[model samples]
Target: KTTTTSHPASISSTTRGLSAPTASHTRPTGPTGPSEPDPGPGSPFFFLWASPDNPYESESTTTSPPGMVVDNRIFEVLLSLPIWLMVYFCHSNVLDLYRKMPKSHKWAFPWLIHLAMGLAAVVSIVFGYARTHHIAPQDVTGNAFVGLNIISNSERIGLLIFAVVALGKIPETIRSLRSLVGRIAMEVMDIESIMDTTEILEVIASPMLLASATIIALTIRDLAKITDLLGSSSGVLLSLVLPGLVYAAIYSTPYLDIKDHDKRWNGHRLGGFSIATFGVGLGTIGFLATVFSW
Candidate 1:
């Protein structure tokens, strides 16, 4: 008998019949990742980025009403806007840069101040975006992407500038705050309460709170910026460990009592503003932390 061989067309038709359907025709019954999670109480940032239901994930089945979505960016904006205000307010607290410069140079300094603030606001915006989006550190580096190096380095340099300025401002900021406390206390609370040691004990807690807030904000911001460039080990340790310890020191120390300011540096009053200054610095750092996050 003559050998009967299937035609190429027939073989191809059989293979097609056995093969899977086209991608366009297929539908996925389940998500590639986990299913939608339950809702929780907290700021949108905590709920969206760090929730027990599902930290770092959102889904269609969320408690959020249908046809409505809260962009966690609102929380990011809330977190960062305060930092802009802090930068503006902190300008007055710097180590008297204008005095060292000539009186003739006064007008020009305002421009520099504006430039610094503007740059800081922009950087804060950038960090806010990165934190909200959960950007991987490695992605921000390398030559494959244009302008990233410049942007990253600029962030780092800006941080250095602010860090130096913030450190120098601590003393004066403390003094100014100490001076303002009595006025604020007088305006809001009774003058008797302002002067009371018992009331002052309650008041003294404010500085540590300031330090804690500062530690949370600045440490996180600095860690976020440097972690990718330098790796997370040192940054993480410094960010988490130092803040607690510093705050503890503030808590443990007896000098956090609200006190008067003295202009001269060489008396029992040298550190008069020290506690308040630390508080102001903490507030600044905390605000900066919001600009970026871990």
Candidate 2:
């Protein structure tokens, strides 16, 4: 869903190598809604959440207040944001990375990598939830070492997989931020020369950006606050809305140099609008959930 006018070369390396683990890193935090009950084994959406037997279903002392109005269904709906956010991260960045590839490689590698990453993400979610879902939410909440503790105490390896994936994301994130900043600069300043001097700019800007980010991270009392904000806004825009809008615009009228038939464009146009509309609703819900959940 992310759009970028920057030279795709800046991100192609990350797209090629980092996706395997990055996708896995994202799946554990994904959300599920009340409407979509886990359909059990063989169902397509089962990978999206843990088992249908939610630990929160019962009125409990640890997880929820007694006689709550909506029961645990409300928690299910609120937890659904991370899955879409994962989609946003994976889907939006792929376009830019794919554009950077030579036409020969474009049709094969990037797509295969995306598919592989998606599969890996699903696997990660299944493995993660299968192990940790038994634990009460209150036990894990605000516990930064939960994963470490889980690994140390048990033979379960789900958290171990996540640890490896998270490590892989560190470099990818650094490069992505640098490229994103450079692209913004190019757009705002109208300086095409900035791309030509990208490495130089990175040398100067990287340290400054890192310092600024470090400062912000230190100052923030709750890192999840920022993550929730970004997930609702940037995540939805890039993952769902922008892609739909771009597709619709490209296929409309003359159809952006693509020589596809009118019939195909008609279906694509409708699908694009549908996706965008869905994104708007999803984003609104996600935003409200984030704000009120606090």
Candidate 3:
């Protein structure tokens, strides 16, 4: 009876040692526990990632949608088109003025002034376009765009010099035009000066004719949107297609006789080649950009 009444020693020891579990022991807690801290003003990640602040985490977590960056860049690039057209118009007008000068005056020191003036107009247009289009120096990512901008800037400087020289020659040009006009009028009144006056008039008219043609072409192509058709083909078509076509037509015309005998090619031919090269290069760059872009 005494042996049977004795309690098991193991069970008694385990019950005696055990105590109620504490909060720290029952659950392993975080350093700050389960409570969230209030957000501060300076934390970007807090605003971007946290709940309650921006409940739409699905939308907020997303990056810019596809093509958005490319679309923005293309928009900026295309915005420069009108400004470039303006520059082309100004340059064409200046060229017309230069063409009107007498052949004797073509290589004269004063002709440099006309060249400078034309260049200035071009430079102003380019820089203005760049500024308006937000094509800042910092925006150029690599050698290509940077090179183009540099070339543009150099052209501007060259144009400034040409314009200053041309301005100085303006007085000379006016005097020449007036003298030629008076001589022609005198010849018209007297049949004797007819041949001489005709020759003089021809000299005076050559540059004017060329200048006028150039300006007209510029107006038609750049101002009138003749180039817009080609734009659908490629972005470079904006700069190359219409101008090339117009110049090609001019070179082919019998009236202009722009082609040099010895060279067997015309200014239009050269211009076309140059423009084609530019268009090809631009296309290549655009293709690369499209391919490598994220």
Candidate achieving the largest lDDT: 2
* Global CA lDDT computed for model 1: 0.32
Model 2: pairs clashing at backbone N, Cα or C within 3 Å:
1-92, 1-238, 31-79, 31-80, 32-80
Residue-by-residue lDDT tens digits, candidate 2, 1-294: 111111111111111111111111111322451121111111112322343443324422222224422323432432343344354443435446545666566446424434533543354343234222322132222112323444353445765575457434544544543454454345336575665667786688668766855764577556445444444544444445555554454444341314453666677667766866776675665557546555
Clashes of each: 3, 5, 13
At residue 285, candidate 3 shows an lDDT of 46
Which ten residues in a row are the worst by lDDT in model 3?
16-25
Write one digit per residue (lDDT tens) for candidate 1, span 128-208.
233222231312211111233445777779867865665555444344334344433443343544556435744775577
List the RMSD of every prediction in angstroms: 20.8, 14.7, 30.0
Score every model by TM-score.
Answer: 0.26, 0.38, 0.24
**Candidate 2 minimal-lDDT segment of 10 residues:** 1-10
Q: Which regions of candidate 1 fall more than 4 Å away from where they truly are?
A: 1-95, 131-294
List, residue by residue over 5-54, the lDDT tens digit for candidate 3.
11111111111110100000011224643322111011112222332323
Per TM-score, what order, best first?
A: 2, 1, 3
Provide the lDDT at 209 for model 1. 52
lDDT of each: 0.32, 0.40, 0.33
